[model samples]
Target: MKIIFNRLYADYLMPSRLGEYEAILRQARDLGYAQLAVRDFYRSRDRSPPGRVLVHRHDIDSDLRTARKLFALESRHGVRATYYFRLCTLDIGFMREIEAAGSEASYHYEEVATFAKQWRIRTPDTLRARFPEIRQQFARNFDSIAERLGCPLATVASHGDFANRKLNVINHELLNDTALRQQCGIECEAYDDALLRHIDIYISDRKHPVYYRPASPFDALGRDRAILFLTHPVQWETNWIDNTRCNARRIIEELAWRTSASC
Candidate 1:
């Protein structure tokens, strides 16, 4: 089973409403989920993740301090979760603290480095001038982040740097760089099938499977072992309008697609 957590929401509430996040922690505890997976990434550098705060780029230090409070809250609730940080924002000391707290840390690879390298908008001359430095910086960022976290970053996930269409295919290039994953000691890539297998293999193919779609929580009553439930804690408690709309659309789209395919 999978439970989705939005790291940004925890960060958002930490500064203004710590209790709200604590409430989420309580809910996760109530749900009997031993691990809570928190997804995190750096903003600025002229790009931001899908729903993170962009203006906070003025100071990375402050942002990290805020993020730590969230980890602390979860710890208070007696739940340990994986913190998936992007390659650009790895802080060794912070990661050490996370590990000390008995939490797991892992990678959030950006797919653009592997598949969308040629999609730069600059002219060949300009591209030649900027490409090497960009790639070098990105690689350094990846390495440093991986190093700070120590302990052979085991799990894998993505930061949505590539297009959504590409994600549907379960691309291994997301974390298959032999030099990197091997050097960093990252274990299994969290492809969809792998996640499904982690929950229950009966509903998922044991080999050559790319993805598995589970019914939404709204429709999961009487469901069996192979369950995957994704709920944004921040959205659920805060009732964030945008999260509500996005999830509504996802449910509607899934239902429509299922109906069409079944016919």
Candidate 2:
């Protein structure tokens, strides 16, 4: 089951393993591309670098430990990347560590969508009607992030939840409201038009069956003059041994979820 899971989900889970991620960082560095965290990149828009630039952004969907591992790798390579962590993965100490390492520490919000699930909001009309409450919840969540981390919150990325897809709602909708953004005191959104306008190529290693998507990390390597490399930390491991072990747990958890859902 481990092998089958690994083969079927290649780039989706643990294929962009730590070793591979390290190699990519080295390659990008060798090709004259210095890593820029998302917050830094957005904040320094007017002073954008002329040479090759790589914005390596990670969305912490599942594991904080894996994020720490990725952070260590980037620190060793002298690369400053961006990490947008979900509320579920927030660890104040680790976030402080990331900031100290010269990387950007930010949020990965999915509150609006998660709330929609809890409220049983399935239709667009219902979503709109309850949006005011959901928006308030969004700001409150940001407050928690700031208070818990005891630091300033700047840039954030919205997580795409399964609920959002099923409801035809975009998670970033919370950030879209100017008033809500002001309430949260947010600086930038990862998907903000201003930030994305400068990216020459957008590459993401989201969940997908190995065969459903191409598997080469090099697919965008060194080819684009400016690149936004988005990845999930949970989908990476240090090596095959770690990857297989992690996959085993993932499989069992998945099976259990399916079993319970079917009941």
Candidate 3:
């Protein structure tokens, strides 16, 4: 007996697989995009090269194995990317390996949301009341991750949690206070106005193509400008068949988590 995949499902599966991702990268390269890691983008402010540039960024939500595979592929193509990792998904070995492979590493933070939820903060006023605790927790987590990596983490990206509506706090808000930036010794948050000024477009593949709709500005890369491409490892697979299965499992798992959290 033979099993057939629906055309719509097959189309949805293309973007998240390894082959499609590689094709995208090759297209960008052919279009004269000089890929830069996040840290490099930060460094090249006034002296940015006169051409199109792609800032490749990866938020490693989970699944270290896939992340490593992506890293290897990028390495082979002579490309470097910045990877932001969550504290909950810390993998020192993989982190070191990726860093060794010429990728930059930074923390993917959601401390504000996590703190607000844990303390049952329901209003912005209440969130402000617990700012001290939140700041301290952020410092501790950052320090611990930095220490483990044996490197000074100069940048961070907020792990946006759209479901938590009560607190109205975002991780990037913690960097609003100059004192917080000084205290944590962090130079830049990925979403900061200063940093965003350099980026002409931002695209992300948070969920697979079918679920998460992204404004794919990269499709029209005719202008000589900076583009930030954010990707997650779990979304990409070796093939569409595997990608479809992975996306299905991820959707179910996310739904279950959200349902339990709501309860």
Candidates 2 and 3 compared: the better one by TM-score is 2
Which tens-of-lDDT digit does each residue in 48-144 have in candidate 1? Answer: 3222111100111123444566677767776555555554445677778877776656655654433333343222333334434544454565666
Q: Any residue pairs clashing in model 3, and if so which?
A: none
lDDT of 3 by residue, 1-263 (tens): 11234434443543447776787678778888888788878778668464888888999866666787788788878888999998867887777876787778889998887775565455677677777888889889999988998888888998876424444667777778888889878888888777789888887774433522345634645563788888887667434444566567657645654555331
Clashing pairs in 2: 14-235
Residue 257, model 2: lDDT of: 37
The C-alpha RMSD in Å for every predicted model, in order, reads 14.4, 4.7, 5.2
Ranking of all predicted structures according to lDDT, beginning with the best and ending with the worst: 2, 3, 1
What would the TM-scores of all predictions be?
0.48, 0.82, 0.80
TM-score of 3: 0.80
How many angstroms is residue 252 displaced in model 3 relative to the true structure, after the best TM-score fit?
12
Per residue, candidate 2 scores C-alpha lDDT tens digits across 76-110 of 99999888878767788988888888888878898
Q: Residue 242 in candidate 1 has what lDDT?
A: 39
User: Which of the numbered candidates is closest to the native, going by highest TM-score?
Assistant: 2
Give me the displacement of residue 241 in model 3, in angstroms.
Answer: 16
Error (Å) of candidate 2 at residue 123 is: 0.9
